[model samples]
Target chain A: MINIILNNRQESIDVDSMTVQELLNHKNFTFKLLVVKINGKLIKRDSYDEAVIRDGDEVTVLHLVSGG
Target chain B: MSEMIDTKIRQHLSRFRVGIAGCGGLGSNCGVALARVGIGELVIVDFDVVEKSNLNRQYYFLKQVGLPKTEALQHNISLIDPTVRITSHNTTIKSDNVAELFGGCDVVVEAFDRADQKVMLIESMSLLLPDTPLISGSGMAGWGNNHLIRCEQYGNLYVCGDQQTEVSPDVPPLAPRVGIVASMQANFVMEILMRKKV
Candidate 1:
């Protein structure tokens, strides 16, 4: 069980995979322009598969889309 | 004859070449504000067309509907200051060419509406142009309280707005709140220009 703030909102999730990429897949985030930050540290795309999502981590999943 | 200006703020702005990513509500309003002050140059990017729906908050006329956003906004801003130079890009901004597109700008305005585009702009701009400042908006949605709109800066990335509201079908972007955040972004740009030596 891990608790993380998703886009400023607090949430807790229990998932099988513990990597950052796995969490994004579990949450079904398919945004093309997503910048993931874990505990204030930016996670580059290359590190997603290896970066671990620990318990009580603060994550900012910024999904860039087209509105303006 | 040259018109006499009262303050040096106007002179400071003349040295800036601001890059605007979106020409919608935020970009259009901010451009108008900068144009009023006669910013030296602007690079306005938008791959959208003016619809009847955009007239509520965006700076476009009813007759301008169906025209491209870049063209419409350029025409509108030109009315405020004919001397201010504006370059319009009729394409979307992606990671690959974003830097090259706005390379010569002094500051970049990230007025995108989508979360993905905003994130892309922030990341790409920060990575490519580390020293250049970027102003963006978040959570300026619905007809909520205008007082909630404020700005917070992280390094050179300054984000303005309520920082909570997300646009939805029920909670739409209105003129008042959008105007507040847009003006805040524009004001920050001018303030940065004034404080920093060009």
Candidate 2:
């Protein structure tokens, strides 16, 4: 069981192993232009592939869409 | 020649002082527009030089290439309105000098191209001038639909860019998009000075 926190919401997901991209896909989030903070450290877009989701890891995804 | 002026609007605009960081694409357009419309005072800051590439979207001429942005922008505003009191800062806004750079400014405009600088400026404003309005720009890129441009206000800070739902890495930053965002920023400043809802 992996505990995922998104925008301050906590949820437990049953997945064997997952990457950031896969998690976003599962959430139906298609936008790639986003800032991912895992435990308060920003994960670069390119490093999304190397980041492995772990159990009880907190992740915050902030969408940077157009807003003035 | 004494002319009749809206006493309320004149009184409102007279006391406002605007600070514009990054005098490049968005800053140039916004600064010029503000000065042209008789804003009380404008403090323009930029640590860049005019390059040939900037002519596309910046409110400068080809002859201004190689000139310091602050100096060139000061001249540009002078041509627009000689009476507009303009202050130019030829250095970049940093954590060390942000307070002095933007001090006494009623509104701060974040128009830098670098994302880190934008974040830094916002944080600095939050710390140094929490009560002042910070109008920021983001997602003014690509050649998408013009109607997508919108303005949002968050407390004392306002952002003029695309909504958080439509952003892609493929979106290339361009001048026209930035211009639209800059105009929105100017409008927000005007509204704030006019005591209108953002």
Candidate 3:
């Protein structure tokens, strides 16, 4: 079981050994132009697949498109 | 007394200062719109000069081709409103002087053409002037159909542009799209000064 906190809400998911991309997919976030902050560090888009999500990790996703 | 207070508030709003970076497509239009609407003080910053290529989108006359963008924009703003307090900085906003460039502004508008410069300006503003609101644009190029723009807030920062999956480095932005986004930026600044949440 992993604790995924998104935008300040905590969620319990039954997934083990999942990559960042897989975690985003599980949460139904399909936008590719998003900036991912995991534990206060920005994860680059190229490293999304290589980064692993552990238990009790906090992830904040921000959409950076469309604004003046 | 209420009438006096209204007069004072109007004076403050008229004296509200805005800083515009880049002075290209988006910057030119934003400055013009702000000046036309009676924004009292404007600080225009840009390091580039006018070329034949910029004449398509940039608001400068053919006779002003060799002039710095900041100077040309100041001239244009003067033509629109001679009483407006307009200052032009013919230098780039770097890490060292960004704070100084944006010092007394109520809001900072990022209208740079380059994505890298835009990112750098945002980071610098976050560090230097955290309380000042920053409005930036992205994805205004390559046949975008959505003319009505949406603004997304990030703390004190607001960004406007299309939500494209990938941004090509070489894609040239057109006038109509950049104008749409720049107007939104100016409107956002107005709303902020008017105490309205964008």
DockQ of each: 0.26, 0.17, 0.22
Give the per-residue lDDT of model 1 (tens digit) for B1-198.
Answer: 135553455777887899999999999999999888868999999999999999878989999999999999999887887888998899999989888889999889999888778887888887788688989888788885867877876557787887668788988888888888889999999888878875
DockQ score for model 2: 0.17
Name the lDDT value of residue B47 in candidate 1: 91
Candidate 3 regions exceeding 4 Å error are: A1-68, B1-12, B165-171, B196-198
Deviating ranges (above 4 Å) for candidate 1: A1-42, A45-68, B1-7
| Location of the lowest summed lDDT over 10 successive residues in candidate 3 chain B | B163-172
Docking class of 1: acceptable
| Interface C-alpha RMSD after superposing true interface residues, each candidate, one decimal | 4.0, 6.3, 5.1
Better of 1 and 3 by TM-score: 1
What C-alpha lDDT, on a 0 to 100 scale, does residue B22 get in candidate 1? 93
Each model's TM-score for chain A is 0.85, 0.85, 0.85
> After aligning candidate 1 to the native by TM-score, how far in Å is the CA of B167 from where it should be?
0.9
**Candidate 2: C-alpha lDDT:** 0.77
lDDT of 2 by residue, B53-101 (tens): 8887888899999999989998999998787788888996898898998
Clashing pairs in 1: A63-B115, A63-B116, A64-B115, A64-B116, A64-B117, A65-B115, A65-B116, A65-B117
DockQ of 3: 0.22
Worst 10 residues of 2 chain B by lDDT: B1-10
Error of 3 at B79 (Å): 0.3
